[model samples]
Target: MSTPYRFPDYQVAGDADTTVFLLHGAYGSKDYFREEIQTLVRAGLRVVAWDAPGYGISPLPPEGLSIERLAETAACLIDREGSKTNIVLGHSMGGIITPAVYAARPDKVHGIVISATAGSFSQKSAQDQETFLAERVEPLRAGNTFRDTAGAVIDSMFAPTSRGPMVDLVREVALSTPADTFCAAITAITRYQGEPNMRNVKVPALLLAGEFDQVGRPQSMQSVQQQFMPHADFVCLPDAAHYAFAEQHALFNEQVLRFIRERVLAQA
Candidate 1:
């Protein structure tokens, strides 16, 4: 059985009826969208970005974390926000989890924005899962700290051309995460089974991929949109990687703001 959902440590901006719950990807805290929050608010959105369980100031789930629990917590947060017409903007593993939130509270979710994520790990074999987890966790277990790995991780996440202060900021925030939290999150995402929920997202969804994203490559993201969400609008940002929004903040924010204004608000 799932534990009762608890509110996570979060930051709020804007005061619109459309509350956007920002779910960060692995190794990221709610701080992930610090740069874009003001812009989103200016475009008329109530942005509520949360530090999901085991990330940032929020304590690790007492019973350990899973995408399922994360979905439950998200639903509670949505309910607390008191909006029937809100958007869920999830990045990376967050993309995998957001659909579950839509399923848990479909009535409340007006739209979903999945950025730089596969939206499923169900395609991975058991052996593949083990290998994936080992490749990430074994190093941390072997005494490599976030600082040691952040540079490489961030490097791989972004294109060479995108490297700059934003990249450094991403690395710095990732460095603050505990090795234990990283492992726990990896385990949860690899073992998650949320593909059905993802496919069943009937609401409007905006799918964004990074042109240089090796993690959530353009083709992979397109496949999800085609196979699962045929109606979703898909865009691949140029000169971007895993953190497409940050790498192309102006365009990213523009797409999201436009989507909400056109697709989401019209429905509401």
Candidate 2:
């Protein structure tokens, strides 16, 4: 018999009619969505941000890290906190997991927002995948922790012009990730075949890409839209990179709220 999966630790805010589940990236926790949470709450939308397994205070799954496992956990959380109108919003690695959550529980998800991620790692060349893995894991093998590499990693995810307390907030969130978690997440992410899941997203969908995002480049996301999510709305935020939600919070929030209002809520 298998042990029941443990739900990750999460934070809830607002009491609005619509609930937005915020999932952070590889090196982030619920706190990474702090700005988004506040903004969404102020905009009258309920928000739930989670610490993906092995992140923040959440315990790692006994079965280890996999995108499927992450999707299952997210589905369970949504079942618990879901509203009449539920929107699952994910960034970077979390973005890859969003569609999987929809595949897991289509009835519960009314909308999905995939931010700063490509459709699948399978789409990348063998050399690109290897380079991605080596860049993240090599430092850990060298006895360095996420704290040691957080600054550089975070710096690379933002637009060159982006700077301020938001940058500091992102750095702090990245620093909190455990080395084991970081390594496991990078491995799981690289191995994920998400195109099938992406194609399965039948709900109202929105794709947000950072204009300067090299990690999940805007061009790649555009390709993803053409191939799998043709029905979904796509927006490339100007002057923003992988961390567009923080780098350009106002624009990011505006698009999200707009999608919910026009695409998701209007139908309701």
Candidate 3:
């Protein structure tokens, strides 16, 4: 039987019909979606943000760690919320969970927004992450700050222009996360193989990429679109990095809201 877990949770704004579920990236919490939540709520949409298992307020799962487990946890959360029609938005690692959620509960999600995140990482990225975490996780568990040890993760996650805010926010989240939980999440990512069938996704998907997001390269995102979601909408946010929403809030919100408005919200 699947275990029940409670993650750090927060509400932004709304009622039954117009609801949105927001998932943050690794080493992140519900706070990651604060700005997006506020904006969406102001526009009369109900929004929800939750920390994934092993991150933020949520308890880590047993020994086994995988994105599929996290997705199951999210599905449970959605069932609890009783949202009738909802758009799901995910950022970075959060993006990995979106498809799983869809796979678990296809009837629940009305649309999806994947920002600055790929369906999966390349072999080179896998090797790099393994090398980077070889010894750092132990130091983190021994009370060394993740901000000090995970600098490379921070550096690679943002573009030069967006580094300032990205650094600050990630540092805050990293410092707050338990060292062991961080290790588990990284392990999950290393082993995760995300959805291979972008075309199999029947729901309307909004693929928003940052012009300079190194983690999820534009080419890889485009490849996913061309190969799988040929009909899916694509938007590139100029002057943005991996954390595109933080770097270009206004444009990000505009593009996202427009997509939701034109596609999902209108149907309701």
Q: How does model 1 score by TM-score?
A: 0.93
Model 2 Cα lDDT, one tens digit per residue, 152-249: 76778889988878777987888788888888888888788999989878889999999998788888888898999899999999989989888888
Q: Candidate 1: where is the Cα deviation over 4 Å?
A: 124-134
**Candidate with best TM-score:** 2
What TM-score fits each model?
0.93, 0.96, 0.86
Clashing residue pairs in candidate 2, if any? none
Compare candidates 2 and 3 on lDDT and give the better one: 2
Q: Evaluated with lDDT, which candidate comes out highest?
A: 2
Q: List the candidate 3 regions with Cα displacement exceeding 4 Å.
A: 1-12, 122-144, 163-167
Stretches off by above 4 angstroms in model 2 are 1-4
Model 2 TM-score on a 0 to 1 scale:
0.96
> Which rank order by lDDT, best down to worst?
2, 1, 3
Cα lDDT of model 3 by residue, 166-260, tens digit:
45765576456666677877677767777553456788888888898766667667777787777778888888777788778889999988988
